[model samples]
Target chain A: MSGIVIIGAGQAAGQAAASLRQEGFEGTITILGDEDSAPYQRPPLSKQYLSGEVGVDRLLVRPEKFYVDKNIDLKTGTRVGSIAPSEKSVTTTGGDRFEYDKLLIATGSRPRILNITGSDLEGIHYLRTMGDVDGIRESMGSASRICIVGGGYIGLEVAAVARTSGLDVTVLEMEDRILQRVTTPEMSAYYHQLHAGRGVNIMTNTTVSGFQGNGSVSAVLCGDEIIEADLVIVGIGIIPNVELAETAGLKCENGIVVDDHCRSSDPDIYAAGDCTNHPNPLLNRRLRLESVPNAMEQARVASANMLGGDRVYAAIPWFWSDQYELKLQMVGFSSDGDSSVIRGDKSTNEFAVFYLNDGKVVAVDAVNSPREFMVCKQLYGKAVNAPDLANPEFELKSLLN
Target chain B: MPQVKFIEFNGTEHVVDASKGESIMVAATNNLVPGIDADCGGECSCATCHVLIDADWQARLGARSEQEESMLDLNPDRTDESRLSCQIPMTDELDGITVRLPEFQY
Candidate 1:
């Protein structure tokens, strides 16, 4: 049997392959990846891995032997050129065609490149894959001053690591504050203070006009101001790799549009991870999430549905980021809430921000507060007293009862 | 290297050698012992690596930290023996410690 053929050997692809085997699918599984290495976790690329606390071996979702022992044919560095959905086959860039009874499109996303003058210069790097991080690590060896363009989670995370590594780090955010797109004003202020206190210079309301250098990047030009830099890292964001899916005649919105079952417009085709804009029944909305938890969970659901089992992907979205010594864990969408109430003491840097709308808890942002974060995860769509949430002595567990 | 015994929900048992200082989750994932997802890669944030330790070896492995306890508290399948495998480092003391994998992570 041609069995199941999965595109993109990422977190979603690895999980889907494992989940299928777990569900007793005794069929051939083939995973196609453009990267030279096997599937690995990307979260640490900006944290421990970049900080040199962990190595590439630990980043693997599963060891190379896993594919061998599980009898999974993982073709690394093989890019699928196009999909002949009608024929149930895919042609790779190398001109090898693989026929499949079932196909899973998990092409994932790519780092959005910064296009401007001198952006093509050497030493300006973007973090997305292992090779990208390896290039940045090599640049860090000879770099003294590093300028980060973008104040998102990635930029701040890389800033934290660079600052801790004793490099002169500066973060330029076009927005008024860092994390403006994903978090509230209070959270943005908290991180701004946190990074500044750690000796990382943060420039808000700043725009990068272009990079300044001949052969290698030496400075970043912001309008008329020149920020001296030995290296430049851009963390603008990512674009979903949906070109293949779109070419295959699959529905494509902001991402590959899929149903609750993670099935695309075609009945036999399924998609997951950063590339799919699936529906969340709990949130009662459709959105694309760029998170490992979402990717893994959706893959599980997609796998089940692929095997003729009914499974809905309605998980409450969650994400975490580690900066300096603080751990920030968030659940649900902060945008769904109208107002937010702070729990615990912000001065001590241990607290939870509960977002509420119409007296119902919609989401939470827990900082160094996993106990409350765990409890908050269960509080989604529940009505709770705001005063009790703000009270430090109030028992959050009682709300469940 | 210390040895770790992982018992799947289906009563299948696999005993593998685990290096000291590495976590039981690492041993399970590295050994290709299914059921331990460890999605967060030992970050303790994702509770996918939840496992129930044998009652006889619970005290030997020591108690879970407050963070670990909080992460475990969310799991409906959690019991007195439940622990995040990522938090339990495989030391010489835990050479023959046995852990049972849960049926589902969530």
Candidate 2:
């Protein structure tokens, strides 16, 4: 057999390689990553790594010797130019060709770049890769005033870090409240107060019309007003890397369309992670999650199916964000929640909001309350009494059943 | 710096010096010790860094907080001495501490 060849050295690809080996696949395994660095955790790039709490050595998913010991071929800094599914082969930018019995497209996602005027100005950066964080870190030292263009997790986390480092930080959000896109207004209000209380200026309903400076960004034009800044970090969001899969005749919608098994249109080809829009039976819709847990879970399912094992990717998606000292852990999706119940006291900064749709618990967003979040995660898609859920005195552990 | 020992379920042992203020999970992952996934990167959200502290060293590590205790409760193989390695910070008192790995952490 020609063995399995994965075309992305990210979280999904790394997990796929490891899971394949653990599943007793003795075939030749090869991974091609565009990045020069080995497969490392991306979650810490904004939190621990950016803050210099963790070193680069600790970010790796596995040690350098792991690939060698497992007999897996890892090609760093190698980009796959195109994929020919008909021939089961892939061509690289460096003019190399390889064939495989099974192929996985774990290309992942890229940071979304704003196309506004002066976006290319110096001193403005996006946090995505190791290099991006390094650039921001270098800029953070000499910069006293920092402006964040988005109020998402990345922007908020970076704001928290910058403020802790004694920088004057200002966050610009186009929405009426921060985290409005993914969270309820109540949750967003809590964060707004948290960041504002920490001496960070958070401007909601603020649009960054453009950037202004002499060679480097010194201020951002937010509508009618201009906010002064020595540095700017844009955390707009990310775009899934689907050009390669789309060009290879694979189905692509918002992302490369994959089944519950993580298989693409081609029989011998599969896709996973942030690049694939896979179907979720629980939600009754297709989801493209940009989370590490989603990536790793899909990779495991894809790896199993690649080895001819029948497995479906059914995972309860969970995400966590660390801002200052608050640990916000969210499970399930709360987009379509019709009703929400707050479990803990919001004034004390310890609470969890449970989202319900059609009387069933669809999601839970817990801040500084992991225990409630853990219990709510198990109750996904199950009906629960909202009053009881909102009652702080209720024993949450007993409701797990 | 404090020295910590991590023993895999398969009987492989690794002893390394750990820096103060960093979590024990960081020490294990930094030393390339196997079986301590710590997938959440010390967030205590994921219990991938589940470890059973040696009975003798349990007191020195102090009591587990309610959050840490609940996180460890998610693990099926958790024991009375079970603690999330990510929750324990490296200190001088934790030097010479031994934590045995679980059969698996997911």
Best by TM-score: 1
**What's the distance in Å from true for residue A217, model 2?**
1.4
Question: Can you tell me which runs of candidate 1 are displaced by over 4 Å?
Answer: B1-3, B7-22, B29-37, B73-79, B91-93, B102-106
lDDT at position A384, candidate 2: 86
Evaluate all candidate structures by whole-model CA lDDT and list the values in order. Answer: 0.90, 0.88
Residues B21-104 of candidate 1 have per-residue lDDT tens digits of 888998897676888878787899878899998688998877889889988876768799999999988899888888899998
Model 2, residue A103: what's the lDDT? 98
Query: For residues A1-401, what per-residue lDDT tens digits would candidate 2 score against the true structure?
Result: 88999999998898889888877899999999999887889998999899999788778876667788779999999999999988999999999998999999999999888888888889999998998999999999999999999999999999999999999999999999999878877788889999999999999889889999989998999778989998999999899999999999999999999999999999899998999999988788898999998898898899989999999988888899999988898988778689888888888889889999999988999888877777766788888889998888877766664
DockQ of each: 0.50, 0.27
> Least lDDT summed over 10 consecutive residues: which range in candidate 2 chain A?
A392-401
Tell me which residue pairs clash in candidate 2.
Answer: none
TM-score of 1: 0.95
- Interface RMSD for model 1 amounts to 2.8
Error of 2 at B19 (Å): 13
